[model samples]
Target: MLSAGPTPRVSLDTWEFVIAAENGTEHRWSWQELMALPQETPMVDIHCVTHWSKLGTTWQGVSLDTLLDGVDTGAHFALAHSYGGYTTNLPLDDLRGGRAWVAHTFDGAPLAPEHGGPARLLVPHLYFWKSAKWVRGIRLKTMDEPGFWETAGYHDYGDPWREQRYQGD
Candidate 1:
């Protein structure tokens, strides 16, 4: 379990995730709103840059494609921001289609705070760090911007299969 800062206490009544785009368009969704969307349980393997891998983990949440539906943007990349100020960057392509999810449940139960509770971005195909925990929003941009770890020496695009961990790995 890794965290950027103290865990945030969120209330279902006031908590909402905001998606902001460079075009000045922003969309907000509450917990109930998100749950109302089509959900899926995907069994995926997660690899951490710290040299650990967890396979066949099941997660349930709304697909990024679903949340992004009708959102028009020419951005080529996205920056995932978390409650505790953690952020990660990825190509917009990595989040489209069925490639990513905003997961709220794990192993058939509500996600625990220690594991990025309320909701977390799950991009299983990339290194686990790219799956920003405590995810709160996504900012789309036309140009690439290195995120927290990326600016701190981690690779800007963390593709696990390619072992892109460090800046030049």
Candidate 2:
């Protein structure tokens, strides 16, 4: 299991997932609320920037499309924020159209805290780090903004197949 630092302890009854728009609008969903939405089981291959690849991983959660349904925004990018002060930026296109999910389960079990429990952003098409753990919300932006790792020299847009690991890679 991978974690940013010490695992965060969350209480199911009080935790929530939020989605904020560039227009100053915000939507919040509790764990039960998210579970009530449409859920999908996606089988994906995850490649870590650190050079490890895990194939055929199964995840179940609400699609990002479903989560953003009916929300209006002219943003071209999204910055996913996590509870542990971790963030990752992705093009809005990468997050929509069934490309990503707010995943809560993995391998037929609830996601472990060390692996980002409660809910995490799952963008399978990009390197695993783009899938921010302990995800709490997404902030829409009309302009791209470098996130935590990106500002730390990781590639702003991490496409594993292209091996975009570092800033100049």
Candidate 3:
């Protein structure tokens, strides 16, 4: 588990996941509420921009589709925010249609803090960096907002299969 900043230990009591729309409306889910949502176990292949890959890994969580149900948004982009201030951007379409999850378990066990415990965004179709660790919320925007690594010269959309790593790659 690689993180750009110090790992944050989030207390479950205060943990919450939010979806803020471009229109300023918000949907909030506390840890308990989130756990009560329908859970799915997805075994997928994850790739990292750093040239590593994990195949058929199992994860348990609510689908982004399920989480976004009833959310009203006219946005075309999404920025994932994490507990440690880490963020990543992705096209809104990339987050829907069963493409992503707010994952809390791995390998049949609670995810360790070192591995982005509490919860993380798991978008296995994209490079792992797009899967924000310790994910706290998602901000829907009408405009594209390049995130932390994107501003640091990493490709705005890191696709391992296409090898979109560096800004010019």
Candidate 4:
């Protein structure tokens, strides 16, 4: 598992996930509330910006589509925020459909903190960095906003297939 800093030991009692819309509306879900939502097991391939690829990894979580079902938003971009202040940007479209999940289980086991336990944003189609770990919320944005890595020269839209690892790549 890769992380930007020391693993954060999060307590379930205080864990919550949120979705902030461009209109200033915030939808929140506590750990229990989140687990009560519909769950899906997705087997997908993940690629890292470092050029490593893992195929057919299994995970269990709620689909982002399910989470955004009734969310009213006109935003075309999204900025994912995570615990420990890590963040990443993605086109809102990339998070819809069945493309992404807020994963809490891996290989049928509770995800380890080092692996973004509690929950993490899983966008398998993009580079792994685009999948923010320990994801707490996503802010819908009318304008594309770059996040942690993006601001530090990483590609704003990281697509592993396109080799978009750097700002100009």
Model 2: per-residue lDDT, tens digit, 1-169? 3355787877789878888999999999998898999999999999998889999999999999998998889999999998878888999999988889999999999999888887889998999889988898999999999998899888999999899998988
* lDDT tens per residue, model 3, 1-169: 3588789999999999999999999999999999999999999999988778999999999999998899999899999999989999999999999989999999999999988998999999888989999999999999999988888888888878889987888
Please write out the lDDT profile of model 1 over residues 1-169, one tens digit for every residue. Answer: 4566788766678768888888999999998999999999989999999899999999999999998898888899999998878988999999998989999999999998879878999999999989988899999989999999899899988888899988888
Model 1 scores a TM of 0.97
Q: lDDT tens digits, residues 37-135, model 4?
A: 999999999999887999999999999999999999999999999988998999999999899999999999999998998789999999998998899
lDDT of 4 at 35: 96
Which ten-residue region of model 1 has the weakest summed lDDT?
Answer: 1-10
Global lDDT of each model? 0.90, 0.90, 0.93, 0.93
**lDDT minimum window of 10 residues, candidate 3:** 1-10
* Per-model TM against the reference: 0.97, 0.96, 0.97, 0.98
How far residue 166's Cα lies from its native spot in candidate 1, in Å, is 0.4
Off by over 4 Å in 2: none
